[model samples]
Target: MGAEAILEKIRKNAEEEAAALAKQGEEKAEAAAGKIRADAEAEAAAILGNARQRAEELEKRERLMAGLQIRKNTLAARRAVMDEAFSLAGEQLADLPKERWEALITRLLLEAAETGAEIMEVPAADREKYEWTPEGNLPIIGEKSFFKRLNAALKESGREGKLTLADAPANVTGGFRLMGPVYDVDASFDALLSQAREDWEQEIYRILYPKDE
Candidate 1:
C-alpha cells in the first residue's frame, strides 16, 4: 500500500521477466546450433558420395580402354603373321626349277602310293612329264610329257599300278595333291614351305627382335 512496498513489487516482477527471457534465448540458440550441425553433416555425406561415384566411373573407363588396346595388339600380330607367310612363299617360288619340281612331284606320288593314296592330282604345267593316258585305267593330267615322266618314275619305283594320276588340275604350284579315302596330302612347294615357315615364325620373330624377349 506504501510507495516502498510498490517499488519492491515492481523490482521482483522485472527480475522474474528477465530470467524468463534469458532462458528463452538459450533454448533458441541451442536449437539453431543443432540445425547447423545436421546441415553440415548432410553436406559432407553428399560430397563424399559424389567423389566415390566419380572415382568408380574413372576406373571403369580405364579398364575399357585397356581391353580395347589389347584387342588391337592381337589383331596386329595376326596380320603380321599372315603377311610374312605369303611373302616367304613368293620368294621361294621365284627360284624353283622344272627338274626340281618334277623330281619333287615324283617323290610325292611314290610316297602317296606307299601311304594308300588311290588318286594323285598335279598341276597342269607338269602333266606331260608323267606319260598320262587320256582314258585308261590310270588317269592322266592334260600335259602329255609330264604324265610320261610321272608314269616312268612310278614304273621304276614299282608303283605304276598303284600310282594313278588325277584328271583334274591342282590348285597349287610345284607340288602334287594326293587324295585317299580318309585323308589328303598336299606336298606342293607352297604348302610344305608354308608349314615350315609357320613352325619357325615364332623363332624367327624372337631372333629378329631379341629385345622383345
Candidate 2:
C-alpha cells in the first residue's frame, strides 16, 4: 500500500477511538448526575418525615396537658360542693325543734311498722317523748328520746306490741334507726344526706360546668 493510504487508515482508527471515549464520558457524567438527584430526594423525604413526627408529638403533649387541667378543675369543684352541703345540713340540724323532732320520730316509727320492724333504736337526745305507753305489750326504753317517740308512735298505730326501743350512741343527730328481728334500717340524717348527694351528683356537675356541653 501507499504511505498516504496507510496514514489515512490510521487517522480513521484514531477518530473512531476518540468518538467512543466521548460517548463513555457522557454516560459517566449522566450516571453521576442521576445519583446526586436521588440522594437529594432521599434527604428531602427524611426531613419531611421528621417534621411531621415533631408536629404530632407537640399535639399529643398539648392534649395531655389540657386533660390534666380539666381533671384538676373538676376535683376542686366537687370538693367545694361537698363542703357546702355539709355546712347546710349542720345548720338545719342545729335549728331543729322538739316538736319537729317528735313528728319526725313518729313518721319514722310508722314507716318501720309498715316494713315489719320488731325493734327500733334512736338518737339519745330524744328519749323524753316516749313516756306514754301504747298497749304495753312491747318493752320501750326511754333512754333515747328518739327511740321512745318511735315506740310511742308505733303503739298508737297498733304496732306498739311489735316494736321495742333501744338507745343508740349519742353521736347521731335527730334521726332514728329501726331494727327488725332480721334486718336493720339506718334512717339517720347522715344516711339521708349521703343519698341526697348521690342523687344530685350529676345535677351538681351540670351546674358547675355548663360550658362543657
lDDT of 1 by residue, 151-207 (tens): 566667765445567889888766778887777788777787778777977887677
Which regions of candidate 1 fall more than 4 Å away from where they truly are?
1-42, 45-49, 52-60, 63-67, 70-78, 103-111, 115-117, 128-161, 188-201
Which candidate has the top score in lDDT?
1
Residue 154's lDDT in candidate 2:
63
Q: Local distance difference test, per candidate?
A: 0.71, 0.69
Q: Compared with the true structure, what per-residue lDDT tens digits does model 2 show for residues 1-213?
A: 999999999999999999999999899989999999999999999999999999999999999989989989978877898779666986686467767756765675576565444656556654444543444343454334445555556667776445655645435675767667667778777777787788987787778768876
